[model samples]
Target: MNTIEFLLSRRSVSVKLITEPGPDDEALDRILRIATRVPDHGKLTPWRIQVLRKDGQARLGDFLAGRFTARHPDANEKQVAFERDRPQRAPLLLVVTAKVRKQHKIPELEQILSGGAVCHNILLAALAEGWAANWITEWPAYDDEVVRLLGHDPETDRILGFLYLGTAAEAPDERPRPELSDVVSRWPQTA
Candidate 1:
């Protein structure tokens, strides 16, 4: 597909529906390289990614499960298992973090937005690499403990997204989008 066609057709496959045969080592490296090719204000490179392979996924799952149980003592085994299996839902997971530099001249908001751009770029790269991709910032993103366990200082870092990459078990349907008229506005040119 051409660039415009690809951009228009790109859709995030559901993480729950993502299956196996994800990007290989070379493909992953290429994806990572492409994912970082985003606008970084002040050239701060404020984003970081943690590739969670099998063992890392397992460890994260265990931590999430324990956290879930602590938060909901009455949660059933199925619920606990759901929390435990979130990371393993996709064949490969990436934790995109906004590592903001408070002392830098760049605004903190800009740094965070740069990290968000990285998350989007990661999804685009994975999709271009023939992998179904989804960017999610579920409960774990807001949990300080989870962030700390991921080896990041929650004070200076925040989880931007959790990118899930894998083969799609089923094609995703296009969802409804906002009308351009409703979303777009013209700012009158100043004299």
Candidate 2:
């Protein structure tokens, strides 16, 4: 597909609708290569990718369940199970971490934005490779314990997104979009 057409037609498949047969190791490596090709101001690659395969997903799910149970002592078994199964929704999960350098010449905000671009690029690359993907950062992404469970210091690293990849059970319908005239504006005045 051409660039314009691809951009216009791109949409995220829901995580629950994503099935198995995700990208293999070689394809995943290629996708990651493309994902990192975004703009970097100072050549400081301020992001990292963490691959959470099947077993890792289960482990993360268990960890999340434990954390949830601890925080919500009055929670029922169903709620705990929900937390435990959350990470297993997708076949593969890629955690994009924004490693912001406070003293670097490049601002911290730019570094964080770079991580966001990485997530978008991953989604695009997966779609181009005929795989459905979704970028998400739910409750676990913000929790300090979850960050530590992912093996990163919560102080310096932030979870930009959890990219879920797999085959789509069914194509998602296009949702309504904003009108260009309503969103776009001219910068300078023309009398």
Give lDDT per model, in order. 0.92, 0.93
Give the local distance difference test score of model 1. Answer: 0.92
Question: 1-191 in candidate 1: lDDT tens per residue?
Answer: 98899998999999878999788889999999988998898999998999988899999999999999999999999999999999999889999999999988899999999999999989999998789999999999999999999989988899999999999999998999889989987788445
Error of 1 at 157 (Å): 0.6
Model 2's lDDT to the true fold?
0.93
The digit string of per-residue lDDT tens for model 2 on 103-143 reads 98899999889989999999999998989999999999999
Clashes of 2: 0
Task: Tell me the spans in candidate 2 whose CA falls farther than 4 Å from its real position.
Answer: none
Go through the candidates in order and give the clash count of each.
0, 0
Q: How far does residue 68 in candidate 1 sit from its true spot (Å)?
A: 0.7
Task: Please list all clashing residue pairs in model 1, or write none if there are none.
Answer: none
Task: Name every residue pair that clashes in candidate 2.
Answer: none
Top candidate (lDDT): 2
RMSD of 2: 1.1
